[model samples]
Target chain A: MTGWLSIFKREFRAYFATPLAYVFIVIFLVLSGVFTFFVGGFYERGQADLLPFFAYLPWLYLFLIPAVAMRLWAEERKSGTLELLMTLPIGISGAVVGKFLAAWAFTAVALGLTFPLVITVNFLGSPDNGAIVSGYLGALLMAGAYLGIGAAVSATTKNQVVAFVLSVTVCFLFTVSGLEIVQAFFPDAVGKEVAKFSFLTRFNDISRGVLDLRDVIYFATLIGFWLFLNRLFLDNAREAG
Target chain B: MAPRLEARSLVKRFGPITAVDHISLKVEAGEVLGFLGPNGAGKTTTMKMLTGFLDPSEGEAYVGGVSVADDPERAKRQIGYLPEGAPAYGDMTPRGFLTFAAETRGLTGAARDAAVARAVHALSLDRVIDQTIETLSKGFRRRVGLAQAILHDPDVLILDEPTDGLDPNQKHDVRNLIDGMRKDKAIIVSTHILEEVEAVCTRVVLIDRGRIVFDGTPAEFRGRAEGAGTLRVILPADAVEDAVEQFEDLDEVSAMDRHPTPDGRVRFTLTGDDRIALINRVTGVIDGAGWPADELELDAGRLDEVFRALTSRETDHQDSNQGQEVRA
Candidate 1:
């Protein structure tokens, strides 16, 4: 447990020590504002809610989450620090979980910075605060899911570019699985089954003022699954090396 | 009491290639074991398995009586490993990197701070402790890696090629550090630098083709050389044949060979069992002939000769086996 906390603290502070954290946060904030006001027509809709902001988040995350998670394992492997970290008196699972949590927490900080949007919605008119809270929970959970995939893919290679591209492609499949354009190619039965796996469908439920237990479970299980894969990949690499 | 570190029939295979064949050894406290091998000779692979960075395909490595294969975390707490190239997080300062290492080793608060301080002071890293590692020089980078490895004051220290790329002075400093620490910790360091074995290692393990070719004290290794004693006399190129002819007839000289140097000087090396008699006779022969010579000396045994003799014998054995296969 101490090992995990030590790694978490170092990994978390490492993000702020470099320019990556500041640059990523600024880009995320600007893109979120642009997507909400211009692309989603927040003012025109004037529904006194952040539905437009919540709707554009998955698309924004397809790129941003990979960027944040790409360096989790890839940088360590590339710099040869992976060997040092592995030889320490810590379980592989602990390091994996510590790194994942650090990336997830950083993403949450970025998400929290969008509090002005929540404040703006409430000041404009009477809005459902409960639904807004659910939306934030749903976004954080979705970020965890995306980060999990990115971290797992990052462990497979020492190149961050490869990790980023592979994570984006995999996350895109999850994001668009339930869309009519993708599901149209399959039969009705297979399409519904594939749609059941879509992150969009689960996130949509929570975004629409409904905190479904099934959605929460889906995100939790998805995060666990990918983190497991991350640990396995790293273990294999260590042995193979 | 159990050995501080032990490898019992440890093996690591990658599909068709066995990088580390069955190898076993032990290092008790207060010993610095020099792992000597040519490139790709499984030295690093063996160290990796012993440090719990890699799982063995067969067998086990124990640290402080705990099997790394069975409980790596427990074994790792007793080890401080400096992997090849002395890798560290290049973005972090040495202070931050050592702090992290100290913390991961289970140190905290004042203990952690004191550990980091000791490491920094020991490695002379105070000047560059706060500077990011990527910006540091190669020698300083290596020292930081060393500092991290010794931060927790582990019971065992495994360093792979720790002085590989450093200048002479830096190498001297590293050797001094190892000499200072060998009193309490069991240290294993791998290098092809034969002189290093003589300099710091209390014991030597020489491996070739993923097998232990020789294992003994450094003095024992030098004693294994083919020539018990050698008399070297540097003469003019034209006089070399004359010197060899004269030395071959002497009763004390067993074998003689003339090696022409690039500087137009011919050197004859005379090997024999009796060092005192051989030296006395060789000097008499050279003095009687009145042969103009630049230098003359006698060596008990040469390490370079021993290393080459051992490693080449393995290659020769392999070649003969392959030749037989081709004929059959």
Candidate 2:
């Protein structure tokens, strides 16, 4: 427990120890505000709920979460600290999960700061707080899903810029794969599978106030699968030096 | 009790290339093993396997009796390693990093605090404990890495080029640290500094081409130099046959080579480790034979030459003067 828990404590504190946490939180709050009020037309489409605000959380996370995760393994690899970290007594899986949870919790904090939208909606009209809770839950899961992919991609390269671009590209595919237009690029049979696996589709489902067990399990497995790949890459990628 | 650390026929292969080939080592407590090898000779790979950071391709490494491959967590718990570059977290302060190392190594509460304090004091990191590692100088960062490795005070410690980038004073300090801890920990240190072997290593293992070419005491390594007790003896050509017979029979002469000088004198070059006695014996033989000889000289022995001779031809970059230029 000390080995695993200490990694979580260290990585989490590391986020706040530098300017990264403040910068990320401020940017996240500003962008979510801009996209919600002006771009998504939160006021004009007001039926007394945060649907307009929740609609763009996926797109906002598409870039921001990767920015937070770009340094996860890429920075370690670049500075050669990956060797130091791996040689520690902590199991690699524990380190991976701890690091991933730290990032997830940081994003959750950034997402949590958007509670003003819930307040504004409830003040204006009768809003279902339960749906707002589910929306936040779905958004956090989607962010974790994005972070999982970003961390795995980050493990593949030492250049953080390359990690950012690769993560954004992969996450974008998972984000829009279920869209009607994007699905047309695939064969009819393959298109259905792509839709079923699309992250935004799951987000939309859970945010609608119906939290299916399978949907929760799907997101969990997605995060798990990416984390598993992240570990495999670390095991082989760190062998060179 | 089992050896503190051991590597049994450890082999690591990348593609068709065998980085560490059939390497086996046993490091017991109270011994500081100097891992001597030129660059690309697989010193880093062997240490990586011993620490359970890299799995061996063909064999096993044991840290305190647990096989690293079969149970890396338990094996790794007993070994503390510093990789080739002494990598550290640049964004973390020394205080934060050492505390993290202590906690991860399973030290908690007062014990963890004491361990961190001891490591910091041992490495003299008190001045820059709060400084971010990236902002610290290279020497300080290297010290921070050492502090992290030794915070737990494991029974087996493996450091790769621990003093690679330090100044003379810092090098002496690190050497003393290793020496001070040698009574309890089995340590393996890989270095290109030939003098460090003499200063710190209880036994030296000279590796070349992924194989152990020479393993012995430092004195033995020096004796194997190109000219430990080498002598140049010039005598009349008529007496060369009789001199050769007498010199060949003497056990003091390990090897002898003959050359014909332009002045019709024969020069015999003799190599031996018993220097004082070799000179005395050769001079007596010359005096007893009633043969006038000239130009008798002995070399003081060169360790750098011995290093290159024992390694491979790839060591052309090695300095002949000494360890002044033997950088890996």
List RMSD in Å for every model shown.
Answer: 6.7, 6.8
lDDT of 2 by residue, B1-328 (tens): 7789988998989888888899988889999999998788889888888887888889999888898888777888888788878898778899999999888888999999999999999999999999999899888988998998899999998999999889999999999999999999999999999999889999888888788888877767877876688888899999999999999988888899999999889999998877767888998899999898898887757777788888756645444545665433
Mind listing the fnat for each candidate? 0.94, 0.77
lDDT of 1 by residue, A196-241 (tens): 8888887888898898988889999999999999999998768645
The alpha-carbon lDDT assigned to residue B290 of candidate 1 equals: 84
For candidate 1, lDDT tens digit of each residue in B1-328?
8899999998888888788889999999899999998788899999999999988899999998999988889999999999999999888999999999998988989999999999999889999988999999999999999999999998999999999888998899899999999999999999989899989999999988688989988867876786656888899877777776888788888888877889989888888767668889988887888878777887768788888888886567668788565321
Candidate 1: which docking quality band? medium
- The residue-level lDDT of candidate 2 at A175 comes to 92
Give lDDT for model 2: 0.88
Per-residue lDDT tens digits for candidate 2, residues A1-241, read 2266888888889999899999999998999899889998988985887877788888989999999999999998988888888888888999899999989988988888988888888889998888888888888889999999999999999999999999999999999998999888999999999998898888887788867888888889999999999999898776765
The candidate maximizing lDDT is 1
In model 1, which runs have C-alpha deviations exceeding 4 angstroms?
A: B228-300, B313-328
